[model samples]
Target: MGDCVIEPEQDYKGRVGDDPPPYIKMPQNIWPKDAPFLREGLYNYYSHVFPLAMKLVRIFALAFGLEEAALDGIFKFPITGMRALHYPPMPKEECGTIGLGAHTDFSWLTMVLQDSVPALEILNKHGQWVQAAPKPNSFVCNVGQYLERQTNGRFVATVHRVRNQTGERRYSLPFFLTPDPDANIHALDSFIAAGERPQYEPFNVGDLYIRRVLPARHRHPTSVKYRDVPESEWKYELLYG
Candidate 1:
């Protein structure tokens, strides 16, 4: 492996944004960098990643007791987002502090390609942090909030955080597969028993993105409209950072 390089953010001036951009982002590839056109690699990964994600969704659908093609409509016009991230080495002084905060992804699913420099961790049922180190070229996949809502919480979405204690720079690529903008997400009728009740109110794909997700400090601009429905009434809804 090549020795990792750590560059001071000041050298890049406005190029790196005010707060190092919360980890290197592939935000529609709009962010600037030394190699601005370095998007070919991302596209290369997406070519394979998207199809794999779709295939996995069908498999999950069957496992969750729904027909294999149950998710076909949602996948027909899905918005699959991909990102390539780079987290520079943290100083020894702030090693314990958070590099990336904890939050649950609202997408249907997320797959990560992590490098040797470790940082990712997930919050387990016991509320303890668990390290998720990389292994060769294998990708780490996580269940997301949408999948949980659709399953009536059958498969809970994981809450994960990142910290870069390694003296070397850390890199990872995460691809998120989300439903079509206008499609609605709800627990399937087939999963409910005669006396069982549905845990959540049906919501459109846009509600989770616009209302809950967009209010973050480093905003992700989107055209999706927000719903006034308070997250409290929806027991299944989870807030975002």
Candidate 2:
């Protein structure tokens, strides 16, 4: 397994929107690494969902008061992934425990297809924790860190967390769409004002991804060769209100 596992370089830093280094990699969790069935099924699902994501991106661009195509280029051949999550009912002893801690998504955007179970909650702009009720045939959408930076902080990524206590299993599918491998992410000029500064720093998509995912603790033995990403910068670094 180590042969295929690439390690990050010594100069790794967790900057949003930066290109990733050659050592960075995403994990594959499909059963039987050699089997193509699960891989193809997921790919086909992404194929059907990617276009919808693009359409939403177009909508997002316009909503941010920029041209429809303003953010479209960044997604060209972007890093995208979809996964099914299952959370079992929390035992009575663990009633107050959190199933998933509070955090923000690292992708440019996230679309969540949730079942009837309602456990996810988001911190709204007014500092209120709003329970995200599952709507039939609806997907909950949220802005991510990259989009927040690109918009000069106009669209703040919603902080969220989930917990299960209803004695029923909860399922959700979230699709994360990030920038292309070589795409550079800096605040768009259109969103900045004259003689004003951009709220974010420039970065490559791949590098930022590596920084966000490389765990701060419980790391693999091979990862010791690389620089460590600061615990303060992890996407879930902030405390839940």
Candidate 3:
């Protein structure tokens, strides 16, 4: 367990293509060397929260009439971490784009604990943005692409966003649960036997993380080349496709 403070104002500046911004402050080796506060918070999260989440997943798996172990391996003793984020108050003019940009998480599951600031929104199927009502003591649970693949689309990876409406600073803790980098996320035969075929080609989790998530952080100054793939092939593709 490791901990670090995320100062969004000081860490992240303008948009991704804007002038080079200052280095964002993040924790080093957050797993074993996490700060005391972070470790404590995460310990409570893992102990109290994860079991309930596991129960929910198990119920869903049983609903599909699959063995509990089918989904168990995907989440068992995973290398998960929690992120503590601080969003500062922005002027009303800049509030539109002040919070997190519309994006999906890159993990199996995410449990978000938000303060009473009330700026989070979820994108509905009709392309409308709807406000997410914050509930007390209940973390916002959302699925990710990895889980969607593991469950053969039985579970959905939803898109969510956050905005800071109040004048005060907002704090949020998002727990990201993931399997090992080399974990295989293909749908099981039992899951696929339910009249739906696998939607995606078999790909390694490490490759997805490197290609998608890692690049968003600490990008290289020059483009790095892969041995067999050409630069033209780097165009973005939806993960579910």
Model 2 ranges off by over 4 Å: 1-30, 33-41, 216-241
Query: How many times do residue backbones clash in model 2?
Result: 12
What is the per-residue lDDT of model 1 for residues 42-154, given as tens digits with 9 covering 90 to 100?
55666677678878989987987779988887665455676667787777887766778998886889998899877899999999999998899698899988888888887
Each prediction's TM-score versus the true structure = 0.75, 0.74, 0.69
How would you encode candidate 2's per-residue C-alpha lDDT over 1-241 as one tens digit per residue? 1111111211112323444434345433325678767656655666567679889989888876789988776765466767778898767787646788999988888888899988889998898878899999888997899888878887888799986656577888888877765678888777898999987899877667656555442464423534354544433111110
Please provide, for model 3 over 142-238, each residue's C-alpha lDDT reduced to its tens digit, 9 standing for 90 to 100: 8888878777777778788886666567888787766645466677566676666687767666567556642564343222333235533542221
The predictions' CA RMSDs to the true structure, in order, are 11.2, 8.2, 10.9
C-alpha positional error of residue 26 in candidate 1 after TM-score superposition, expressed in Å: 18
Q: What stretches of model 1 exceed 4 Å from their correct place?
A: 1-37, 217-241
Q: For candidate 2, give the lDDT.
A: 0.68
What 10-residue stretch in candidate 3 is worst by lDDT? 3-12
The candidate scoring highest on lDDT is 2
Better of 1 and 3 by TM-score: 1
lDDT agreement of model 3 with the native: 0.61
